[model samples]
Target: MRKLLSILMILLSIQAFAQDDKSKDRIDYSGEYNGTFTDIKDAEGTMQLFLYQPDKGRTSGIILLTRIVNGKSEVTTGTINIEGNGEFISGNFMPSEIKYIAPREDEDGIMQNTYDSYSCRWEIFGQITDKKGNTIIGKAVPANCVESNLIEFRINKKK
Candidate 1:
């Protein structure tokens, strides 16, 4: 009976160590990430992102700038909280809102000016790819606004 008890204790110790190591292997996504928005028309720009873990199952980041379309840009200098569930990523933003709506063509063959507020729920469906081509698929939901005036882009972490 003593030998059997000893074996059980050894198994429990091994399990505990395994759990500790697994937690230590958690990925650290806290850094400046450069990526492009890939799902928009005439969208060509890079975004600087700062990511951090505020608590368990919660990650937050901020976009320094979102340059989309020529001569048009939006600055999100405020903090945006993002949460992760499994392979999904989502968040929201406020205090930094700008809109660029499409101009309407008038009879004079000129575009009419129309100003609107920017409110969009930015959604990205892609993966974080490494230099070796390995990808970590995920999604991001921004809480800045409900409807965007311009097209959105999918971002892949830049190398």
Candidate 2:
């Protein structure tokens, strides 16, 4: 009877540990994010972000361009998937390509127009948070880069 009781206690401990582990892998992101695109050549814009955390370890949102060249505004939707346990987050933008006119000087000394596509990718590294102001003990380094361009942004989450 004592041996059986000991085995039962061990099982209970194992179950509790498993639950804790699962909880630690959860992430919560619910807030408005304002991002500035630095290191961009010949581009001026401020990106307004709205993020919704439908569940742990997952986030989705839309990014709007409040300012850009030619007085044009654009919006794009994207998803963020985070692995809390690994402290890594990666996501891709839908319609992943944006076209814009490249600024150039022509023989006439006037700005000539050339179309170019910019590809975007978001990568984040930091600690995941929960609703009750509790953080899942981890780290995240979030970065966004445009392909084929020298533009890249690396932002650390503000405490």
Candidate 3:
């Protein structure tokens, strides 16, 4: 019985050490990341983010989400906030504007209509993934719950 108890105690200590090590393996989420997303079948969208350290334990940045709708590209800007204690790899994408760009003409005789482009208010939560921490995956839900389909995105950092 004593020998079994000793083995169990050793295993518990190892498990605690592993938890500490895993917490220490936090990724530094800085620099720029770009990737694509899909909300539905064949729906293509792009995402770009630039993260920087504003202060100690505070990371902020600007992200752009460009989605194609009816053959025209629409842009939505969001403010990124990674406000946590030591874990700065997970955060959110808060919509800055429903539509960063209004539908207009391109100087020539072409009408680029992106009406209601600013109507996308998705609550997106992103988390860093991969062993090397070079990738980020996120899921979003429309603010008004209009989009029942899953809105998933994945971004990667450049080497």
Candidate 4:
């Protein structure tokens, strides 16, 4: 009887641990979010965001800009620092840098260093209120470039 009871307890413990592991994936801020930036002149069109939880109070996601200011598809990777669990979340999109070879005329008026490189980059910011349930509504702000503007967005947990 003692051996049987011990075996049962061990099985139950294993089951409980497994359940706990699954909860890690059900984070409050993990989901697919869809919304638009409020400022239409600077940035028009819609944006989609996919956010996932790496650990508690942290989130990682991708931001997709469609038909915005530049009339081109833009994708950005971002991280958010969540405080008060799901009360507040804010982060900036890591700037995407492009390096390309450019040919420029030297002082002697001769094209030289055709392999010379140049880079351009832009960044965006997100500040939102976490509903603590399944929705996060926030604003997307552009920075580090020409214009600084605000865009509103709301993201919900994916079913």
State how far residue 1 of model 4 sits from its true place (Å): 33
Residues 12-130 of candidate 4 have per-residue lDDT tens digits of 99999998897664446667777664453554556666877665546666665554335665443334333334455556664344434576798999875432111223233334444
Deviation (Å) of 105 in candidate 1: 12
| Reference-based lDDT, residue 51, model 4 | 71
TM-score of 3: 0.59
Model 1 clash pairs are: 38-154, 90-141, 92-143, 93-143, 119-145, 119-146, 120-145
Full candidate order by lDDT, most accurate first: 3, 4, 1, 2
Q: For residues 123-148, could you state the per-residue lDDT of candidate 1 as single tens digits? A: 44444454322234433344454333
Write out the backbone clash pairs for model 4: 33-155, 37-151, 37-152, 38-152
Q: Estimate each model's TM-score.
A: 0.54, 0.50, 0.59, 0.50
Select the stronger candidate by lDDT from 2 and 4: 4
Candidate 2: the clashing residue pairs are: 124-142, 125-140, 125-141, 126-139, 126-140, 126-141
lDDT score of residue 57 within candidate 3: 46
User: lDDT score of model 3?
Assistant: 0.69
**Clashes per candidate (backbone, < 3 Å):** 7, 6, 2, 4
Q: Which candidate, 1 or 3, would have the higher TM-score against the true structure?
A: 3
Per-residue lDDT tens digits of candidate 2, residues 43-143?
64454445677655466666444335567664434444443333444444433444556768999999854643233554434333444423333222223
